[model samples]
Structure formats: C-alpha cells, structure tokens
Target: MANAISASPTSTDPGRIGVAVIDQDGKRPVQISAQFAVAADSSTRFQIVVSDLTDATEEVALFFCGPIRDGLDLEEVNQGPLVLSQAPNSPARYDSVLGDRSECSYTTSRLEPGHQTIVVGQSRYSFLARTGANVLYTVPGVRTVLTREDLGGETMAPLDPASTVSITMAGLPNDLQIAAAVPQLPDSGLPSWSYEVGGQPRVPGEYRVMGHLVTVENRAQATVFFAGAFVGISGAAVLWLIEILVTGALGGRPRGEPADRWEQTKERPPPRS
Candidate 1:
C-alpha cells in the first residue's frame, strides 16, 4: 500500500477510515461518528468529541478497526484488526481539578500514521470511608523504605486467597526488597507484602505491593476503597484531536509513533451485549 504515492491530491489513497469514541464526562463514555480522509502519503485524522461534561475527569479514548460495518458490533473481533486495549499514552492535560485516587491513563498504540483508531474514555473516582474515628499522628522524620508493585496489568480479581501469586514490585529503596521467601497469606485471604520506598517508614504510601486479594481477616468480606475512576474507561483513543491535525499539517510527524504491541495488549474481557 506504500508504493502508491505522489504529490497530486487525487493520487493519494483514502486508506481505511477509523472510529473514534469521545468521553466528555470523564465518567461516562459515548461513541462518536466515524471519519475518513486521504493522507498525503497515507495520512488522515479523526476526532470524537464528547457532548456531555457532568464529570470533572473527562477524558477520551480511540480504537482502530478494519472498517465500519453493521456486523462490527456483532462480536469482539480480534482478527487482523488491531485492538488497542487502552487509552493513548500522551500526558493528559486535565482541564479540571484532581482529587485523591483520580488518575488519567492513555494507551501507547499508534495506528498507522494517517490511518488510526480513536476511542474516548473517562475517569471517575469514589472513595470509601471506614467507620472509625479520624486520627492524626506526627512522628519524627525518618527515612522510609518502600516497595511498589507495577502489576504490569495483572488483573487482581478472581484470585484465590489460598493460592500464591507473583506480583512485580518496582521502585524499591535499595535497603528493602520483596522478601524473596514465600510471604504468608493473611488469614483473611488477602496477600500482603512489605518494603520501604522512602520517607519515614511508617508514613502511608511507603510500602506498596499488588496482591491478588487483600481480604480482611475473619470478615468474609472484601472492601475496595478505590472504585475505578471507571468513569468511562475507553480503548485506544486520541486527545485534542484537532491539535493533532494542525500539528501534522504544520510539518510535524504525520502521526504519533505506534507503541509496542507487547505493552498495548491487555487482559480484556469478552465484549458485552
């Protein structure tokens, strides 16, 4: 497809147009109409805008597909069509205020320079407050050792507390590391690990590890304080798409670079009805 190229406007091929989903609410997601255009040598752009803005963490996601057809909605097609499982990777310019646990993530999939996929995703955050008296304590500043679990996209759900799982912990303080020895599973069924990152050892966020399940002992219950800013988690999407077009036309790289599929590929569930 790269062989056919020329300076004439009519000489270029209008490669497969793409679909874009825009999330204006950053909580709920909506799909925008598809767009198509011919690339100078295989360049095109599509923008999916959100019509609603009731949420503060509004974001967008983009997905690429072979072509739009009525059957496109029939099944989770994983064929040749590249399925960018997450949002774009560019730093998100949050036009709204950020609260605790509020985060914006983008995928690094770069659809063909001119040919690309566009989808929009939004983020919403909700926190759970346990029934307890609020207490604050100050301590002498001490160097804190911390351990971080990157998880690398490992799903924490559906894990058995009785079973052992391996989680990757990064950004560790030189003095501390995940005890290579098998750590004991909490009687509550949640897995816990300890390590020091920095700061006073007792400070929160000092030691962190991704556990399959962090069950409270003898409670026979699970408490998740972090609800996904599930606002509107979208698939491979583009942000400020208009800026992208302007930048490209002004003699910038025709399109953003594609990300390694190994990283973009995610543990996606089957499409829902």
Candidate 2:
C-alpha cells in the first residue's frame, strides 16, 4: 500500500512530499528522520504533515517558537486563520494545501482527527522558502536519543545531572532555523511506535527528538504571485471603468477627485446583529 501523505505544502517540483509524525504510546508527536538533496540550480518545496491522533474533537493551532536568534514569535506571525475543525466532513484530508499566511508557510488543512489515525498516520507542515532553491536535508541511522541519567550514588555524593541531548542537522540554509515542543510525557523506558509497529523497543534506555526544519518556502517569491493576481484584478476593473466613461454609461456628472487614501476611506458603521 502507498504510504499515507499528511498535511504538506506545494513544492516547486511535480511530486508530492510528506511529513510523518510517529507517535508511540499515543503521546507527543515525533517527526521522523528524512533526507533531501538539491541540484545547483534546482528548487524544491516542502510540506509538514502533523497527525492529531485523538478520537474526541478539539481545536488545533500550529505555533512556531525559537532558538532566540531565529526570533519567531507565535502572536506576531499568526495573523491568518489558525483554527481547523476536527470532524468527518472537514476538507483538510486532501493533500498539497498551499499558501502563505505570513513569513510562515502552509498549504491546505488536513483535519482528520479520528480514532483510526494511528502509527505512520501523518499530518503535513511547510518549510519557509528561500530564493531560487533549497534542500530538505535528512540524515540516515541517526535517531534523537532523549535520556535522563539517574544519580545512583550515596547521599554523600553529588547528584548526577540528566543531560537532554538532541542530535542536530547541519548544512541547511543560513536563514533557516528549528523549534521543537513536546505534547506529552514519556511512559516506560521505550518509545511506543517501536513496540507497536516494530514489535520491540528501538532504544533500551535513551532517545532524543530529531531536529528538522519546515521551511518558510519563500515569502518574497509568493508575494510576486499575489501581486500578479492583484494586478490582474485591478486591470480588469480599470478596463470596466474606461468603458463606462467613454460610453456615457455613468449617466451623471463625474464625482469629485478620487478620495486620496490619506483621507480615511469612509468607515462603515458597525453592522447591527
């Protein structure tokens, strides 16, 4: 069977890309390890599929935070609609939802929060685009090992500190960055996906959450497209006005000079409920 593709954004290429979140013990989401390659002049797109594996319905929103240097704040960037309804009829189930809400990118909504959504179940996310091209780099054999070392010494000895180690990915675009947040806590010493799908715990003791990027996928480039669309609409409107002016279709004296935008466009009074 074909692997189920989750919420992902449109790519510059023709094929579909996927984001897989492996949830063991039905807990916090873990993005799987992936590798990407780009030719010198070629460009690519990425989509992040975030699978919500709960039977009960809930409102879901995606937030981006940071390494302090990345400077991403959830409130400033989340201007567009973020809430998606979790129901049988919601339309996000389809793939390749595209468009930019702001500096962050997203395509379509794949809201399929249901009981059947299980291991290998996916939800797609997006990567911020640079200029001509970028690579979605993935690594092989490397797993995020998260370990909590217990101080097994007597009271007299100092307690051993548990270090949270995260394996980092290198060779990405300089402007790109990563932010991770956990949705749940670890249970037994094993990851749930390994036990349920692979029939054994992948790690005997420790594990780390792999760090990856969901690119902005080029806000400036996307703006060019939006500009083209706006110009097309404006051109059509201008043409219509000229026809009215030449054919005497306005049927009245010309209104005073077009109100300068500096003159507040007359505010419409609020509508009564």
Candidate 3:
C-alpha cells in the first residue's frame, strides 16, 4: 500500500472548501463539484466529487480556507477513485484574523484506478458560525526532486557532498522561481556555497530569493523567507523581502550584492514548521 497520513478533524465551525486535482502525467485537469446539506444542531455535510477523464494517476488536495469557528469533523465515505490521505497544511499566516485552519489531500493509483470519475463523498459535521469567507486555490501538479551524492572515500576525502534540488509547479497562471540555502554538506573544501538558478551560480552568502510571475497585463511577486537558526545564547531573526518588478524581468547583479533593494523588518517569524 502507498504511505498515507491522516489528521483528526479539529473543529466544529462551518468552513469553506477548496479543491484541486493534480495529474502526474500532465494530461488532464479534472473538474470538481461540491454539495452541502445542513443538518440539525447547525452542522453540515459536504460531498465533493472529481471527474477524471484521463488515464493518468491523480492526486486531489483540499484546503479548508476559512475564518469559521473551531472544531470540524471530516468523515470520508464512498471514496470512488482516490485513496484518501491528509498532509499538514501549508502556512497561511497572511490571514491573522482566522484561527487554525484545516488542509488535507487524497491520491489515486495509476493501476487499479477508477474508470471515469472519483468521488470524495464526506460528511463534515460543523457548527454554524459566521466569521469570514474561505476561498480555494488549486494546483494541478507540483513536482519536487532532491538528490545528493557523496564525494569522499575511506582514505581520501574531497570535502562536502553535492546536492541538486528542484521544485516545479504546473498549471500555474504564471511562472514561479525559488532559491534558498542549499543544505550544508559535511566538511567540504569550499568554505561556503554558491546558490544556483537556471545553471547560474549566485553569491556565496545568505540571500533573499525572489520570484516574479509576469503576464501580459500584470506581474505577481513572491519572496522566499528563511527560518532562523540558533547558534549560541542569542539568535537573530533573518528576514528579507525581494521587490518583485511588474515587468517580471530579473536583472543580473554582481556577487555579494544585496538581493533586496530595501530592507523589511521581520514580520511574524516564518510559520512554525
């Protein structure tokens, strides 16, 4: 069996639902429809179904993005084509007013799969509380690859090992890029490491990575945040924001140049892992 994770429903608050389908073969984007029936005691039962027209294996992720009240119970029944699993929610610290949120995912196997459609018919017993609206974001497929190779032998050693990591996002309206400190390889010849993007090596120190999604009309910006590490008695909060240009053009800067044009004070520390 494929590995799976599950989470206990955390709240009874009426919540909004968001769903996205991920096709590994990059062939199909499934259409999803949801139905809700309110029960007595101010609870609701939600039924979400996905229609998969292609043969490729699919993964469906759901996010309960809401400012609803606390406590929800999610029961999965009649799972048509998907094997249900729940992964921890990604940080949504942007919305401070909302309390804790719920996020989960389900997967379908390439073999022994359903014929045409997958159903996630689950009942969510939630409380009737008016807080705010919850919206859903869909990511068709996300690809991540990480590889490492050792460079030392029994007698002779070069230094630290080399690593290659990449993250690919598909079905996104705009292109997204990410950069960060490569994992530290043990006792390497090089004192520090240089970050690379598109095969170009960047400066040798900690950098605030930035990515811009440019379109014909507007550009969207994203900044990479680094969590701080403690060295001794006192620790410093390392935070920086890279200005995303509307044109989505990235200018080449010399090594050791500041990645951010201006500095930003540390907001809330990067959401706790």
Candidate 4:
C-alpha cells in the first residue's frame, strides 16, 4: 500500500494508532469502530469491530495498536480466510512490555476481500482517571502501532486517513451524572472519545494510549449547605474530614471569633420596645 508508513527498527513509530487494517490494494481505508466498557472498579472492556472494504481475494492483515492487557483474541469472524499470528515476541502481541510501545502490534489471520471481525477484550489498562475531591470529582477517560506482517512478519500500517473511526464509553455507574464530554454531543446526548490531530479525526493509536474525556457529578461530594456551616467531605476513596470548607457558624457566633467577644456583642431590642 503506497499510503502505508514504514516502521523504524530503532526509534518508535509515531503513526501507530488505534486498530489499523492494511489493504494491499490501498484502494480504500478500513473501517474501525470501538466502544469502551468502563467499570467503577476501574476495569475496562474493549469491544471493537473492524472491516476491510477493499475486499481483496487474498488475505490481508488486521493490526491492533492498543494495550495488551488481555491480548487480542477474536470473538467472531466471517466464514472466509483468517489466521492468528501470536507467540513470544511475535509481531502480533500486546503493544509492549517496557519501552517503545509502538513496537507492539497484533496481527490477525487473513481476511478475504472486505471482511469484518467482532473482538471483545479487557485491559487493566487505561483511559479512566479522577481529579478533585470526592464532592466534585471527575472519572475521566481512558495506544500504539507499527508495520511489519501477518501470519508472516507483517508490517502493520498506520491508520488510514480516510478511515472512519469512532469511540464511545459504556458501563459507567448508574449514579454518574455527566457534566461535560469531549467532541461535544448531539441529540443522542451520549459522550465519547474522539481521536484526532489538528482538529482532524482518525489519529493513529498504536504507540500512544488513547481515550475520551468525561466529567461526571459525584453526588456524595456535590455539596449541600446547612443552617450553620457546611460539612467538609473528601471525595477520595478514603474519606477525609474536609479538604475544603471549614466549620463556621452561620446563625451562631462565627469562625475565628473570640467566644467572649461574641457573647458580649449582643443585639439590642428596638428603642420603643
């Protein structure tokens, strides 16, 4: 494929991104779609479906440029040609072990002209995060690539510029209140991760970890005022007294006020009374 970028033996590749499909004909780019199922426990399931529109008579390579948390295994496939290329250090494996994650690529068996596969896997890996105290916390979201072979030593291709790829998150806790999400939203009102460069969509995923951004309302720490003083509650797992507001009397005395001064300073009734 003329549009395909070559991998460097020494330095990591930059174009490596989300799942990529190499079409020998390079006629049209493959179509890849993904959904991230995130659990409150921080565990995640990656459900991906990739299809090659070129539909070559021979087999082509399917490259996965993501974490190897559970290795890439097929959930379903078409009744055409296909093979698996995975072994110790084989070109087809999780992204990487220590350095240069871009070197990791998972190559799948052959696909006879325009084939699709349904893949479901998990990762103790990423895209989920939290900032701020428990009261106003955010559980934020949550890859790589290279070239080289199929059942043979394949050179995985970079994501095709014309390729259409979309990602969304799932399995969030029921109480989670979405405050904001990236790439904006539509009538669906659902939030998702957008992988793009320079405002253009479909950036590569191989070498870098990627995910969408989302801010959810943490009800427990959202905050509520009382008659006098507000309770400080930390949103973190191990709750702390209050990383924020302190106890200040609202109707009583006041914060930092000397008890004697407060007692002596009393309001007098109206002169007529």
Give one digit per residue, the lDDT tens place, for model 1 in 220-243: 221221222232332223444665
Which scores better on TM-score, 1 or 4? 4
lDDT string, candidate 2, 120-143, tens digits: 111222222222232232211212
Candidate 3 has an lDDT of 0.29
What is the C-alpha local distance difference test score of each model? 0.23, 0.26, 0.29, 0.41
- Judging by TM-score against the true structure, name the best candidate: 4
Question: How many clashing residue pairs, candidate 4?
Answer: 33
lDDT of 4 by residue, 232-260 (tens): 33244224223222332234654456888
Error of 4 at 197 (Å): 9.9
Ranking by lDDT: 4, 3, 2, 1
* Sequence-dependent TM-score of model 4: 0.47
Error of 4 at 67 (Å): 5.2
Steric clash pairs (candidate 3):
11-71, 11-72, 12-70, 12-71, 12-72, 12-127, 159-188, 160-188
For residues 114-225, what per-residue lDDT tens digits would candidate 3 score against the true structure? 5333333333343222211111111111111111111111111111112121221112223322212123322542212222221212211111112222331121111111
Span of ten consecutive residues with least summed lDDT in model 4? 1-10
- The TM-score that candidate 3 achieves is 0.29
RMSD over all Cα atoms, model 2:
24.3
Candidate 1 global lDDT: 0.23
Instruction: Tell me how candidate 4 scores on lDDT.
Output: 0.41
Candidate 4 Cα errors over 4 Å, as ranges: 1-17, 57-105, 112-114, 130-151, 154-160, 186-188, 193-273
Which model, 3 or 4, shows the larger lDDT?
4
